[model samples]
Target: MRNLFFILFILIFVSCKEDVLPKPKAYLSLKYPAKSYKKLHFERPYVFDVEKNATVKDSKNNWLTIKYPNLKATIDITYRPIKNNLKELLIESEKLVFKHTVKAEQIVSNDFINESEKVFGSIYEITGNAASQIQFHATDSTEHFIKGALYFYTQPNYDSILPAVDFVKKDIVRIMETLRWKD
Candidate 1:
């Protein structure tokens, strides 16, 4: 009886698991393609550079959807001719960005200015589980205004998709850098 009691005590102590808390969520690690860019060929109100691997869906209203098939992601571009609504357009763009504030851990903005090229804009990087990880708006402040948002086809898992967001964020910068408003 004593031997059996000792074995039971040992089993109880030895098999005790440190509280089996659920495992922390894990993110994916991925490989990306080499980077190269080409000028967008479609005739439009503006011209910019895009990743050679991406396919663009053009709309009659001058909006564009830059699709990355492998990543199952897209960068949607919206175009507006700046007649007299620059302020309104700017506000609207910011409003669209802030729509994610409820879910975003934080939103960061980086201003892009190329006075020589007449391209001025801000790129917003939203952290956490926001629907859009990156967004931007660029303009000549007179003739053209363009806003872009990044989205993934799958659910928004910010950490898992961060590398993809970063990959496209650089492309958006390239777009802002190479932007030229058509006359």
Candidate 2:
């Protein structure tokens, strides 16, 4: 009976032992495919390079959506004729960007100027949980004005989507760099 009690006590003591060490931090590692771009030529008055993996959907009034189905994101592109409403158009575009300021940590503007291509615009990179991660407007300052915004279909979790956002930002920059207004 004494041996049985000793064995039971030993077992209980061993089972009660606890390791109080803190757990190592864990993070999600996401991998995406190497990016390849193809020139997009539509009947519209503009052309740009887009990721080959994205699908382009045409909407009314020369507006289009570049869908990244795998990433659950889309880039909405709208084309407008300057038509002497340049001020109004500029104000509207800026207003659209500022709307996200409430949720945005910071908004960085990068001027895009290609004298040879006659492309002049600004690209706004918004960091934080904003609805739109990137917004851009490219125009020839005369006839054609095109605006684009990048948005994810999912809730805006900036940390969770950082990788995807960075990937798409590069594509957006490429588009802005290669944009050409049709003569």
Candidate 3:
């Protein structure tokens, strides 16, 4: 009887293990809390113009950014004419970051250099007790920029919401990768 019980338990365990599903695959992934949200759209000039859904609002009707909660995680996805060029855009963007992040610790700047598409941008990560990240992507037709920020109390740095950031970044990349200029 003892041997039969042990065998039965082992079989059950093995079956359960086998039935477990593998982790979900994605361009990016992050852990986050459960909540409800809605999408929003913002209109800028030639700099960035696109529809931004998946937004949360506070009681005061202030826009709550989905990517980062602290500094408007709101994404400004737009297309601009290549008349200015990437070099000038880079300088202007750097100046913007410096002006805004006066109290922030500049994390680092990253670039996505593509010979065929000529896509380029920089990502700035700031650290304090909590951290926030920002990015600026520019092309000839238009520029796509996003400022992602999170409060210290929100999550423990990258361990918690980093995956979500990555997941959303992937989504943004997908959107950019398939971007088409409206004639």
Q: What is the number of backbone collisions in each predicted candidate, taken in the order shown?
A: 0, 0, 12
CA lDDT, every model vs. true structure: 0.93, 0.93, 0.44
Candidate with better lDDT, 2 vs 3:
2
Give the better candidate number (1 or 2) by TM-score. Answer: 2
Badly placed stretches (over 4 Å) of model 1 are 1-29
- Between prediction 1 and prediction 3, the one with superior TM-score is 1
Q: Which ranking of candidates, highest TM-score first?
A: 2, 1, 3
lDDT by residue (tens digit), candidate 2, 1-183? 999999999998899778679999998788888999998856778988989989999898889899999999999999999999999999999999999999999999999999999999999999999999999999999999999999999999998999999999999999999998888
- Please estimate how well model 1 matches the true structure, expressed as its whole-model Cα lDDT: 0.93
The model with the greatest lDDT is 2
Candidate 2 stretches with Cα past 4 Å from truth are 1-5, 12-20
**lDDT (Cα, tens digit) per residue for candidate 1, span 77-154:** 999999999999999999999999999999999999999988899999999898889999999999999999999999
Per-residue alpha-carbon lDDT of candidate 3 for residues 1-183, written as tens digits (9 for 90 to 100): 999999999998888865668888655343444432322333232122222434433322222333334423444333334464656655766675565464555456655554465444445554332334444554533543332233333533554455555545554554344333223
Candidate 2 positional error at 121, Å: 0.9
**Between candidates 1 and 2, the lDDT winner:** 2
User: lDDT score, residue 39, model 1?
Assistant: 93
Model 1, C-alpha of 104: deviation from truth (Å): 0.2
